[model samples]
Target: GGAKYLFPGIAGPDIINFTHWLGALVTSMHTIGVKDTPTRRVIHRAADFLPIPLLCIAMVLKGHDLHGLYIGPHSEAFSAAADLSAQLNIITVDRPFNHVLSMPSTMYDDLWTAAKAMYKTEPAIADGGEVIIFAPHITEVSYTHGRLIDQVGYHVKDYFLKQWDRFKDIPGSILAHSTHVKGSGTYDLATNTETPRIQVTLATSIPAERCRRINLGYLDYRDINPQTWQGREQEGILVVPHAGEILYRAKNLSNTATKGPHRSISGGASTS
Candidate 1:
């Protein structure tokens, strides 16, 4: 007298990618009012590289109740394909699943190195000055706000100008963009040997003109090395060995878009 069809929703790509034939047999069992469906596997580690394959293998190894699987933000396998397939089913589904990564190792190491290097030199951003950080956009996509802070480091905050005022400030006061600057180096020209001048070169993914247009500097990635930092001229420059690993937060000049002072993982890539 009520509804003729009994539908169940699958959360994450796990159901679509791992389950065979929509687990139709199990769903059918539930449709007939079967009260109990066994769970084949329970996934706890959402951070693993590919969690869906693991879920699929477990489901096939020891059948499960298609209706019993519960999914949430922690289920990391959600994707476009999974979402599309869900449209075909009329069942009331569970809410979507998602999660966040703590931080990439490359970023941690780079930040630590930069912090130590800058301690003696102490790079500063004056009251009206700015410090720009350029990286591939994909790099920012991989970081959460908290992880970004770890990559940016706490000590750097001491250098921010307290009375800063600007119409437009990059996120966190640091610009994270698609441009790439891997390394930098300096060349010396000893003309007449009086006061030798140094010429610096930057290796990057984009051309020098683009960097100039955006008011950012450039350096070739390969030019920088261990010995380069030892030079006196290099003292003030903070080198981030790997942009993909580091996440940075720039200081905000305005209060309207102020984030939490605690510096939590406020933003990052979203999981389906």
Candidate 2:
């Protein structure tokens, strides 16, 4: 919970499972007794918070019935989930500067590939009763959703407005306060908030917090005809399913948006 970012709240053998630092903490305790009880009590405090953390994991994951793995820039949520491992279907990944969609597209592909390889769960089954809902932070999606602004779907501007409102309501949001487990990289509610309209660092430059709103809007407004949440096409059914679903979806969507606008001249004639 402190600088280590591991589950220090939990005491006993469980702490050993937290991180390398925790194993050391336990080792230290065995070899040398510390004066402060806070050091020892952290593990139990974590143990006590188990049920609440589990409830949170359930709520965050309830959007999709499948295995919900939260790839975070930090591991607070996962550590919290670790306590109630029996009740939760979740995994966490923490990489510095890796706040959701900030990573490259290749990284996302690699991540999905690795996850698929490891879990080996069919996209249909892993998706639970409904589609799998994988919600990343959405930084890049904000800048890119504008290209799809005029397409036959919701306007990017209006989409962002709704997204801002909804983000305040998500499970672990400060406004919602509904989740027992806390989200990592949260900003202080009192300060460090700014509107893109107010403080102009650059054209359309918004703070990370507000930027999140735009990204959320992108997700809400996307033309999913070409994309997969967990996996597969929503409109097209595959002969073999999942394996060819993405390619199948690509065929149905307007390729112009993905590749580039068509470049045929009005007076073009066949020239040898």
Which candidate has the highest TM-score of all?
1
Clash-forming residue pairs, model 2 = 9-42, 9-43, 9-46, 10-43, 10-46, 11-43, 11-44
Ten-residue segment with the worst summed lDDT in candidate 1? 1-10
State TM-scores per candidate: 0.21, 0.18
Task: Please give the distance, in angstroms, between residue 107's alpha carbon in candidate 1 and its true position after superposition.
Answer: 14
The 0-to-1 C-alpha lDDT of every candidate, in the order given, reads 0.23, 0.23
Residue runs of model 2 more than 4 Å from their true location after superposition: 1-88, 92-174, 178-222, 225-272
Q: Give per-residue CA lDDT, model 1, range 190-225, as digits (tens).
A: 331211011112123434553344323344333334
Worst 10 residues of 2 by lDDT: 176-185
